[model samples]
Target: MDDPRSRILPLLRQGERLLWVGQPDPRVRFTGADALLVPFSILWGGFAAFWEFMVVTTAKEPFFMLWGIPFVLVGL
Candidate 1:
């Protein structure tokens, strides 16, 4: 309980080995990659939300909605 790693180590079985452990940095910084990824992620999320909303609200047969279910679930 004192350390998070203590809880994780017990779950490994025989012959299983952990190679490396690291903590995430707390600092937030913007970079060139973010400039491209941020917009795509936003557009994807918006589309997924709109698609799901339309499926639930308007569609009757909704076979096309099946195609978008995985994309909507992953986007959110």
Candidate 2:
């Protein structure tokens, strides 16, 4: 009996490019399957959290004072 899967393998191999379409392969994932989404989500979330923290802290401060003056004077 001839296997169709075996015939398809040669064509797949000859393509010479990798795409996430094969089954039982090492790179395949069905959930959170996209490679770029996880890292992008993490970076975006971290920046957003830092921005919110700075805004809230500044709002609660009673007076706006020079926090970065000494370093500026020393550098010049």
Q: TM-scores, in order shown? A: 0.66, 0.35
The digit string of per-residue lDDT tens for model 2 on 1-76 reads 6765666667765546534443586665645544676766666666655544565577555332233333333323
- Residue 51 of model 1 has an lDDT of 84
Q: Model 2: runs farther than 4 Å from truth?
A: 1-33, 59-76
Backbone Cα, N, C clashes tallied per candidate:
0, 0
**lDDT, candidate 1, residue 29?**
77
lDDT of each: 0.80, 0.53
Q: Lowest-scoring 10 consecutive residues by lDDT in candidate 1?
A: 19-28
RMSD of each: 3.1, 14.4
Per-residue lDDT, model 2, residue 75, is 29
